[model samples]
Target: MIRGQCLITNKDDQYNDPDVAVILGSDKNPTCESQSVLMAPKIKLSSGYDMPILGFGTYNLNGYQCLTAIHSAVESGYRHFDTAFNHENERQIGEALRTQIQMGNVSRENIFLTTKLWNIHHDPRDVRRICEHQLNLLGFEYIDLYLMQFPVGYRHMCDEILTPINDISVLTTDVDYVDTWRAMEELVKLGLVRSIGLSNFNMEQIQRIIQCSSSKPVVNQIEIWPGFMQKDLVDYCRYNGIVVTAFAPLGQPNREKHTPIYFFSEGMKRLVKKYKRSAAQIVLRYLVDYGVIPIPKAGNPLHIKENLKIFDFKLEEIDIRALRGIKSKERLVQYENIKNHKFYPFERED
Candidate 1:
């Protein structure tokens, strides 16, 4: 959002930046090309906007690791970064950008940045203020995309919409989703955010908001994987032209029990052997082929290196069909507290 004119202060422009270490010495690295980027798809979202198919995930990223990961991801050709207010690493994200600028690795123009407005900041009046606070914390001019973390609104408030029964998180029918969306729209119009999106919202909530918004949201960031494939929601969003951004692409490891690597079923195992790839790569590529951008989480450089090596071999149709048939519909990060929220749409009818 650096308006007046775009300036490059980093390495050289891989995609329009003037800075990203361009060595026109005519020395091509055969190894780099052989690994991937052969048929790498440059995905464009609904609004004709493009970002790298793979993005960097910073969910539990904190402290020194967050800073280092941000730098490493960039040097490795990751231009899209996803962070949230709850992540508590905005300052580090900002610090890494400054460090890379000094290192001549990346520039402001070459990155597509996204951050979320926490559920606590969903108030119609306070949304703008909260977004401004995020900008200040991230030390950026303007955010590339900002998302309302979920369908969070104050509960039991008696206003023009409806009268209150009691003080609680479960809202009444008078909850004003349109009012909240209008406020978010104002953020985009004011140039505080380039685009607006949603995360953890249900079909009913998104349908209601999209009906009234001045701008249709271009992205729907949510949790989608082989285990927890919310097919109904996926169909609805894709039909409306909302690009899906998946979080927790790999099933989260049971850190406490450290017993979670069961995602690799027999079918996946055979496919991995046939493809000569890791389970993580298979999982990531499966989602990518399904038209959802997968943000695989990893802090270790070697793991991160493996995570992004997804574009090399395409997932065959047989592999995709087999993966689809094996869906367990399991959710790893279901926050049960949300069941008390007014818009708790995760309730299973079955």
Candidate 2:
């Protein structure tokens, strides 16, 4: 059974170091920042599990880099990890986590690990097979949370081919997501996963699932940042008791020529100076305060430590108002390839 209580700390007890020098020191002495790093508080999921509000995202990380980043994140006091089978790094993640467990750094019970079921495996028959394969890759008894990767389904060419395509576009399957959700609920009953949820699914899709399934989704993972808050959808999910996990919470500032305007806006600059925090830190804190878990991916050691420090401070109401008022309505992660599918969640862009 997954068990734990939320670790509530006073706002004044937050670590105040702006440089994060203590947490970024040499790995030889791992205990240097043990007491300095503030552990993130946990939010109870409807599935009866406690998930840390700030999670580590492993989307593009692979091989040695992936392993090293996980170690760094663990050292920086991160307890929640987000990955997908399509991310293609579960094997390395499992190895890194197993190493940590062997070294007595963290236990399985305390770590909240979340992975997704790929669209190709949406057929109810293939769901269990793919989940078990993922377990073998992860080398875990059961997953903490397993999310339906998207509302749409894709053709199953083979186990290795994640995105099977043809001359027309990506080949989509006729499998209904409700059927996929039913198969996922079976996973919970069979002890393959502790909790089940949805990802990249819009409000209408989520409503359909709620109407049909006996086990309601505890989470809806999606893209959320200052630029595109998806207010109505977020409000709908919250009203239905579904927790939102924000991916790309920093707005992918590294994207060439497409840097999020908020990153350089004078308003954001003022808030950064006022709080003595980085732009990334301010946005992350704002999202958390806005009531969602932000899983920002960082391979750099300094960034890993910096991301974890947001738990120490609370964003003021006026600052929150300023952030919410940002007018840019750009959505960063549009899965354009599958947009033509009948169940494509987002509105078709011209």
- The numbered model that scores best in TM-score is 2
Give the least accurate 10-residue stretch of model 2, judged by summed lDDT.
18-27
lDDT of 1 by residue, 129-248 (tens): 878988988888888878877665544232223223345433433346567778988998898888888888888888888878767777888888776778888889999988888998
- CA lDDT of each prediction against the hidden true structure: 0.70, 0.85
Off by over 4 Å in 1: 1-41, 154-175, 254-262, 348-350
On the 0 to 100 scale, the lDDT of residue 300 in model 2 is 99
What's the TM-score of each model vs. the native? Answer: 0.80, 0.90
Query: Model 2 lDDT vs. the true structure?
Result: 0.85
Q: Clashes in model 1: which pairs?
A: 11-19, 11-20, 11-21, 12-19, 12-20, 12-21, 13-17
* Clash tally for model 1: 7
* Strongest candidate by lDDT: 2
